[model samples]
Target: MTKWKAVIFGFILAVMVKSFFAQYEFVGLLIVGFITGYLAHDGAIGGMWNAAVAGALGTIVCAILFIIIATLGGSLFGIFGGLTGFTLSGITSITVIIGYLIYYAIVMGITGAFGGALASKK
Candidate 1:
């Protein structure tokens, strides 16, 4: 498959896994990584780079979806009170979430690269 196909597959797979198994969301990333790497290998491309790109794309898509959901839920539930209150706690929460997302993406990318390396060896 092409790189775009791999990216789309990874994104959908990640989203589905995350939605169905919230507790084991990392598994979704791992699966995406593996699939992307395998596809890259089959395509005779740079397996590591392609897999990493797929991982990044999948993670980014998932993060954006989560952010949208969180924003809507917060607005509907009025979880943060007023803007003033949100300014403080919200900043911290957002920062933490962003940090976690970045870390998650990096880890997933590394995992993808590993999978790509394994595939290339075969």
Candidate 2:
């Protein structure tokens, strides 16, 4: 229950923060991870895993949203409208997005783990 709550809270906060201050996204993600970890505290090990998953989930959700928005905009406007604004398509674009997802997952997961470790109840 606590873990789920933390995950939902973290996800919501992640979206809300990104919607407003899109520039400082990493910082907001870290803060959300920390708060989620702190809220879902169990033991160091459990907390770390839960928090890391929550953080990664947030990143995945954000990436999905980005893809959706970019696809819609690119289709309507005849351009790739994502962060990179690349015109690349097919395998190359897939590779880029996959790489981005992996990178973001690791980065966000690490921050969450650190937070969980520090805030562990046991």
Candidate 3:
């Protein structure tokens, strides 16, 4: 495959993987995919295989980061609300959780992809 093809394929694959991990973070995934495409084009990895590996690593890293951030944020927010004696409706609670997940995706995905690129030198 040509260089361009490898880049495109790797980007798409990266986006798909990111989306699978976090359904509500499609835009985040797309941004990461674009970054991976740039890295692939720059020969940071080598080809599609390397790009795929990098992308997968990036997704895993971001997933872990997001999980941690979201869980902690949610728990902390809940605790604060409880301390203040704020009663949250079911829908409100759900919305808060989903909102945390969205924040996690954006922060984690971008940082993780850059981290993956930095750590991977093949």
Candidate 4:
């Protein structure tokens, strides 16, 4: 297939996957993006390792962003008296972090697979 087709198809796949998971889980969109990217490209064992590293980085970034946004949202609600209070603690905190990690990992893995394939001439 042409490079343009691969990119377009990858993007569509990413968006669809993102849409499907976003409602059910957080960080779905980014995960989908990573997966789309990885799948669209090419790689090897070393590439997988690179993907894992990238995935971890992506997860951390998403998790941090989520936490910040969530915290800000909660604070805003509290200020508006829409909510009494919101906080991440213990299991809730852990779960959120882990969820982000998993989502990113899946995304990275998928993207890496695609990337690896694309990178190869044959």
Candidate 5:
């Protein structure tokens, strides 16, 4: 498979695993890196690179989605309570997301390289 296609497949599988392991934040993300690497089918370096990209993208997407969902839920709560939607503005700051993105990218990159080595051997 092409590199992008492998990354897409890896990302999809990572989401599924993440959904199941949602309660364990670090574990979920680490598993995502492994899944991305295994499915990458691009040998060591490629798998590592693809998994890192997928992991970074996943972190960003999940953060945004979480914020959106929280906002919607807040809106619903506000409607029932006759209050305006409470903002989670502080948590949604770009700086926070960037910090998380960097952390995840680093963790996933190293973990993914390990996974990629395993994949290439198999």
Candidate 6:
């Protein structure tokens, strides 16, 4: 499979896994990294880089989706408004989301690289 396809597939898999087993979110991410690394493995291309790219992309997609869902849910349920009655502002929410995106990219990227390297051995 192509890199983009692998990224998409990994993202979907991660989301499904997280939804079903919220406590094992890291395991889902690790699985996604492994799958992407396996799929992108080529004798010429480095598996680590491929897997890292896939992980980063997948995590970014997840972050975006999460932000969208949170925004909708907050609007519909007024969830954000009840938070100490301080009300979460748009800037604060955006900042938090961006921080999470970076955190996910770095953490998941390393995991993916490791998985890709392992897959490359065989």
The number of the candidate with the highest lDDT is 5
> Where in model 5 is the C-alpha error above 4 Å?
13-20, 76-92
lDDT of 6 by residue, 10-119 (tens): 66676676567768877766667667666665422444455556555655666666655665565444655343232445456667657755654555556666656666
lDDT of 4 by residue, 1-120 (tens): 223433444445434444455574334444444444454454443334445455555556555655555555665454333223334253467776787567655655555555555565
lDDT of each: 0.61, 0.64, 0.48, 0.49, 0.66, 0.59
Residue 24 miss distance in model 4 (angstroms): 12
Stretches of model 3 off by over 4 angstroms after superposition:
1-46, 76-122
How many clashing pairs per prediction, in order? 0, 0, 1, 17, 0, 0
For all predicted structures, in order, the TM-scores are: 0.63, 0.67, 0.30, 0.48, 0.70, 0.63
Which regions of candidate 1 deviate over 4 angstroms?
42-45, 75-90
What are the per-residue Cα lDDT tens digits for candidate 1 across 64-113?
A: 67655555555544644443455556556766666655655565566666
- On residues 6-115, what C-alpha lDDT tens digit does candidate 2 reach at each position? 77787678667667877997787777767766766654455555556665566667767766776666644544454345434544666755665565445555666666
- Ranking of models by lDDT: 5, 2, 1, 6, 4, 3
* Clashes by residue pair, model 1: none
What is the per-residue lDDT of model 5 for residues 15-108, given as tens digits with 9 covering 90 to 100? 5544566677677767767767776756667767887777677667767676665556664454433223324364456677788778767666
Candidate 4 regions exceeding 4 Å error are 1-42, 76-90
Predicted structure 2, TM vs. truth: 0.67
- Candidate 6 runs further than 4 Å off: 42-45, 67-88
| Best-fitting candidate, scored by TM-score | 5
Candidate 6 residue pairs in backbone clash: none
Alpha-carbon error at 95 in model 1, in Å?
A: 3.0
Output the lDDT of residue 72, model 6: 53
Lowest lDDT sum, 10 consecutive residues, model 4, at 79-88
